[model samples]
Target: MLIGVFAASLAFQAGSAFAESYQGLLKKGYTVGKMSQGKSGSLGWVLTGKDGKQFCKSKVSLAVVDKKTLVSILASGRMVKVDRATFEAGIGGPDPSLPLLSDLKAGRVGPQHVGACTPLRG
Candidate 1:
């Protein structure tokens, strides 16, 4: 019984220790690069810092919706359904009018306005 309790405690600690959110890391100056595949065949974005240093080696994947690929998840885990066109705008681009990574960090687009961003455990 004591062993069981110890193991449960360890499991909880391990999960919490590594459960850093995508937004949390982005707030720390991490930039999301192009999508890439991991050794396990899973897709995720490469995270880099302002200094050009790679952050997570394995990377994290995002899931916008259950069946639909377009969706946004907030830190609270609230899923907001969005359309493809809207999702593209959230992506930003050469158009300065749209929100970019810098705007994301600057709070131009609220968390809800952003698309799905799930960080994969490397």
Candidate 2:
């Protein structure tokens, strides 16, 4: 019984995390711009809002398992939330603990706060 409960907990965690992807962002009216690699080896992305004004730009760390893409914010210098003109300007802050998941094969993204991009500037 203990083993079964542990397995269930793991499954639950996976389900909760396996959400949010490039396609998912598009469906939600977000435009994911080109992905660039910074000198620190982090992936940078500029996702614009539906109206094309506000955006979320941050250096991210990505992990690919099978067809799943797990991305975490590697925010280390001047984070922008949603109020900026240039896409890439600042760079000087501490790292964040936000994680987002995306499934490449199934094209699914998820558990509620998947689209959250707070405390970041454009």
Q: lDDT of all the models against the reference?
A: 0.45, 0.39
Backbone clash tally (model 1): 2
Q: What is the lDDT of residue 105 in candidate 2?
A: 18
lDDT of 1 by residue, 1-122 (tens): 99999999999898676545457667878766654443444433455654343323322122333223443433433445556455556776222233233333333343333333434433
After superposition, the stretches of candidate 2 with alpha carbons farther than 4 Å from their true spots are: 1-18, 38-40, 44-122
Model 1 segments more than 4 A misplaced: 48-122
Q: Estimated TM-score per prediction?
A: 0.35, 0.25
Which candidate achieves the best lDDT against the true structure?
Answer: 1
Candidate 2 per-residue C-alpha lDDT over 32-103 given as tens digits, one digit per residue, 9 for 90 to 100: 445433344433444556434222234233323322222333544222343121211343432233333233
What lDDT score is found at residue 117 in candidate 1? Answer: 42
Total colliding residue pairs, candidate 2 = 12
Q: How well does candidate 1 match the true structure in TM-score terms?
A: 0.35
